[model samples]
Target: MERAISASDANQRFSELLREVAEGESFTVMSRGRAVARVLPVDRAREQRSIQHLLKFVAALPVRHAGNWSRDELYE
Candidate 1:
């Protein structure tokens, strides 16, 4: 579960909070008692990008680059 902290507290403990986030802890930064932002591990962000890249890779089909094969050649 994500930990919750007030915006002010987040500001005060920003460095430590960043360390915690880097270690895989998540947080909900609250403003006026309402959640305003979330902090997540960097790995999660990388994973999201990798997943998106993989999805695009599969969706594009014919997994090959143009270094040795041209696009038109794929149909031939």
Candidate 2:
């Protein structure tokens, strides 16, 4: 569960908040007693793997052909 913190408090302790987040603590920033934003640490390994998968998928796509028919042509 994320800890809730008021906006003013978050602003006042931004550096400390970042340190906590880096240590695996997530937070929900509130404005007017309402949740406004979330602060969480990124999973670098997962993020890097996701980017690698995307790059590989894009690289494997077939190149376009000059005589290729559009989807409309297939429907017709």
Candidate 3:
């Protein structure tokens, strides 16, 4: 579950918040009683590897052209 914290409190305890996030605790920053932002840890290396894999997969896809057909033929 994400903990809700006021924006002022978040700013006042930024370092503490970072430590909590590093320890896997998540938080949502609130402004005017409305959620505004989230703080969480991320695995940069894993994200980059995933993106690279996606790029390679897309690059290997075959490119094909539609055979000669009129707009009306497509609708039919």
> Quick one: best TM-score, which candidate?
2
User: So what's the TM-score on candidate 2?
Assistant: 0.69
Q: Where in model 3 is the C-alpha error above 4 Å?
A: 43-46, 53-76
* Clash pairs (backbone) in predicted model 1: none
lDDT of 1 at 42: 68
Lowest lDDT block of 10, candidate 1: 62-71
Return the TM-score for each candidate structure.
Answer: 0.58, 0.69, 0.62
lDDT tens per residue, model 2, 1-76? 6899999999999999999999999999999989999999999999999999999999999998779789999899
lDDT of 3 by residue, 1-76 (tens): 7899999999999999999999989999999999999998888899999999999999999998889999999999
Comparison by lDDT, 2 against 3, better one: 2
> What RMSD, rounded to one decimal, does every model reach?
7.7, 7.3, 8.1
- Clashing pairs for predicted structure model 2, backbone only: none
- Per-candidate clashes, comma-separated: 0, 0, 0
- CA shift of 50, model 2, Å: 1.8
Q: By TM-score, highest first, what's the ranking?
A: 2, 3, 1
